[model samples]
Target: MSAPYVLVLYYSRHGATRSMAQQIARGIEQAGIEARVRTVPPVSTQCEATLPAVPNEGDIYCTEADLKDCAGLALGSPTRFGNMASALKHFVDSTSGLWMSGALIGKPASVFSSTSSLHGGQETTLLSMMLPLMHHGMVIAGIPYSETALLNTQTGGTPYGATHVAGSDSNRPLDEHETTLCQAQGRHLGQLALKLQD
Candidate 1:
């Protein structure tokens, strides 16, 4: 049988959310399971005319089978007016078939997000992402106060999930606290996934 893996699925327009996805993947792998990183193409065009089947670069697009087979999921996106980007939400909406099949039922899932400003709706974005997963019957995971970084982060990091403040130009890389929270959140979800499997 293939090894169990966590799906780190994200939509990143400016690379900040992608970097958070990588950090989360590293933490998932630390739990001795595989991490599969995937991204959804933008929804600017119709389904038939959107991105090519294969991306020109970066992570490959996620398939239904990938989402169906994951033991855990880490969803990331940039904040879009107090919610996840429409592109990511559009992709999530496509997984109705999986939901009907109960493909994600009981799976451990978490969310992360990036924002251009400190108060740019990071928590609301993360919360919005969870609504779909909850409907899928996935067990939601979040960082607890024990993480310490969550306690001290003046920029981003919420019990809702890990988040980043990418600054006005969207150029600010994740600060130390945000990075730590991302990894810690991933580790928490990874451990939960393994435990649920048993």
Candidate 2:
């Protein structure tokens, strides 16, 4: 068998969500598993138009094979009216083949998000991301209360998943609580993946 890896998949317009994905990946690696960071291309409205096979910047584009082979997943996206971004959603919606085959069943999964405002649907976006994974039969994981950050965070940290308040300008870096929760969520999913592997 190949080494276990947690796929950190995300889409970010201004880089906040992408930063969170990096932190989560750091935590996943800290838990003694590999972290494969990937991103989906933005969708265009022009009929039949498509993005290039590889993104021009940041992480490489995620492949169906990456999703199929991952032992765990950390999905992230910027909130779009209390939902995941259209680009990430578009990519995930294309995974029905895996869902039909039950290829992702029993894998561990978690979610994260970043929003422009404090109440801009962070939790809802996280939950929205989880719905399809649940349909794929993946076990959902979230940040537990044991992570002190959940209690201390005034910006963003929820039991549903890790989140960040990027503020109206989308320039605010993750606060301490956001960082800790991201790491904790990543570690939580990684540990669960290990246990599930055994």
Q: What's model 2's lDDT at 91?
A: 93
Worst 10 residues of 2 by lDDT: 46-55
Candidate 2 local lDDT, 47-83, one digit each (tens): 4235576777899999999999999999999999999
State the lDDT of candidate 1 residue by residue for 1-198, as single tens digits. Answer: 687899999999989999999999988988878889999998775654555877888999998899999999999999999999988998899899999999999999999999999899998999989999999999999999999998899998999899999999988988999999998988888888888884
Candidate 2 wrongly placed segments (more than 4 Å): 46-50
Candidate topping lDDT: 2
TM-score (C-alpha) between model 1 and the true structure: 0.97
Instruction: In candidate 1, list every pair of residues with a backbone clash.
Output: none
Q: How close is candidate 2 to the true structure, as a TM-score?
A: 0.96
Q: Estimate the TM-score of every prediction.
A: 0.97, 0.96
